[model samples]
Target: MTSTFHVRGGRPLKGEITVRGAKNLVSKAMVAALLGEEPSLLRSVPDIRDVAIVTELLKVHGVKVDRDVATGLIRMDPSNVERAHAAEIDAHAGSSRIPILFCGPLLHRLGEAIIPDLGGCRIGDRPINYHLDVLREFGAHVDKRELGIHITAPNGLKGTKIHLEYPSVGATEQVLLTAVRAEGVTELTNAAVEPEIEDLIAVLQKMGALITLQTDRTITIEGVERLGGYEHVAIPDRIEAASWACAALVTKGDVFVQGAQQKPMSTFLNVFRRIGGGLDITDDGIRFFHPGEPLRSIAMETDVHPGFMTDWQQPLVVALTQAEGISIVHETVYENRLGFTSALNDMGARIQVYRECLGGSSCRFGWRNFNHSAVISGPKALHGADITVPDLRGGFSYLIAALGAEGISSIHGIDLIDRGYESFREKLTALGAEYWED
Candidate 1:
């Protein structure tokens, strides 16, 4: 069944919503459970499609997964993990890129692993070569087959040094999961230091993995003989928190996001403040609201951790439409993320995407023809239109546009949002958002 959201516009959203464990972190932590010799308990797990996908994948591998939806708790036992059939694995994987992550753990536990063609949101050209190359570096033999790419560690997995061309988070995760149980010490340079990555490291540490993060983007992991279970609470979802913050600004509303943290979101909070949004940081959570003053335009660039995130670019772009003057956004992380702006333009947002890199320093896509930079000319009045959700982040941004538009918007492909945000429809209702699902 296809899911659609019919949203009525021109009303401000106001109220409180809670964010749970990060969609980015929880799925990976689920994969981490495969390395544990015993059962592991995870708390603050969100009710999202990705988590469900991981749970199913684990079950297929003979891992016992006990889940409590109400408390957002998951107990995963990988003590009996075994090889699953290729077709079954492929069927369970569906369009998720998660299966790629199973390679290391499966290889370590069963001496072989098979990963089918991976799929994810159409946000960028995220290649799997980084993952495959890291696996090969660790003595895994990769073979191309009709069923999927089969990997085997004949000589047993051994650790090695790896340096990433870019600080890719997924590839870093692939290395951490594989390296924690390899035969020797592993060192990774130019690794991604996202808070989610750190949280995963914490999970591994709890499982008896010795990992260290240096001042530089280098991470060192010492392979251990055995790993035990861990009970861990994941970090809050900063992307979702920032999304709601942008929603509050776009709709001229106030939203108190419980479970939102201040440290991981420091960069986003600075950007939100620079755009003239109000933020009240506390020990518990952060409160975001419009200051009733005209929103200001600012030049921003998306980068890795400790910088403005690419996921924040979309929703913030929708809010930028209501800002006075021109706001420049340079999406350096994803080469094609700005493609979603066309839908916003259709809703009367004056956003122009350009191939040439704009705002601060030139990036990896500086010379590419892809439209990676966006110039938003705003304070433009928006009218609702028929909208199609593009990707996860873009889909949420479309909802914000619909809520702020003047008329009703029929939004299709809203199920994409379920891949990330948890209880979004209920949260929208709590925030006084006028919407219905069909």
Candidate 2:
């Protein structure tokens, strides 16, 4: 069944909301359980579609995944795992980038793996060239099959140095997971230093893996002979936190986001403050509101971790439409990220896309008609309209845009929003948002 959200706009949202575990970290943590010799326990897991898909994928691979919905805890036991059925495995091929992380653990346990085509956010040509290059560097024989990637480490996997041309999150994670079980030491330079990556490392360390973080740019791993099961609490969702923060700005409301840690969200908080958004950090969360002045325009550039996240860019761009002056956004992560801005433009926004690098960064999308840069001229009154959500973050941006617009908005493809958001309908209702499913 498909669900769409019918939202009545122009409401000032109030009240407190708690964020769930990090979607990015929880999925990777589930995959890490496959590498363990015993059952691993993961806490703070969110009830979402992508996590459910990953759990099913692990079950098909002969891993026993026991999920406790009430407690948000999951136990995965791969002790008796042997082989994965291709038909069952292929059903979820191209579902997410996460399934690819299983390649290393599968090869480590069964000596071979057949991975189906990968799928995730379609913001650009997110090619797996970097993944294949890093895996082959570690002595894995990779062959492209009709259905997916066929890999074998007949001579056994060995550790090697990998240098990524771009600090891609997926590629960096693939290297870390695959290299942790290799025969020797693996050195990775120019890796993505996202907080989720750090969380994964912490989980690996708890499982008795010999890993060290040398500076923010490099990681050194000494492959161990065996890994033990571990128990860990996943980090809070920073992307979700930032999205709700933008919701406060767009609606000119006050919202308190519980469980949103400030340590990992410092960069985003700084940007929000620069745009005239107010923040107050408490023991367990952060509260966002606009008290006196309207939002101000600021320049933004998306990059790897510790920089502006690409996932948060869409929602923030929507909020920028209510700002005073012109706002510039340069997307350095994905080429097609700015395409969703057209939907906002349909609702009376002055946003222009350009093919050249407008904000002093040479992005991959700059020369290819990808329109890597966006210039938003705003303080315009937005009217609600029917809009279609293109992807996860884009869908959330539409929700924020709708909350600040006049009249009614009918948003389609709302199920995509559920892939990451948990009980979003109930939460919005609690915060004074009039949303219903039709």
| The candidate that achieves the highest lDDT relative to the unseen native structure | 1
- Model 1 alpha-carbon drift over 4 Å, by segment: none
Give the alpha carbon lDDT tens digit for every residue of 1-438 in model 2: 556888998998899898878999999999988888988999989888888888988988888999987678999999976777656777864457767788888889889887787778788887777778878888999999887788899988899988888888888889888888999999999988899999999999998898888785889999988998999999999999999999998898999999999999998999999999999999879999977698899988988878888888998999899999999999988888899989899988889998888776687766677788999998888899999999999999999999989989999989989889977887898899998787
* Local distance difference test values of all predictions, in order: 0.93, 0.88
Would you give me the overall lDDT of model 1?
A: 0.93
Q: What is the TM-score (0 to 1) of candidate 2?
A: 0.97
Q: For candidate 1, list the clashing residue pairs, or say none.
A: none
Q: Tell me the lDDT of model 2 at 201.
A: 95
Which number leads on TM-score?
Answer: 1
Worst 10 residues of 2 by lDDT: 86-95
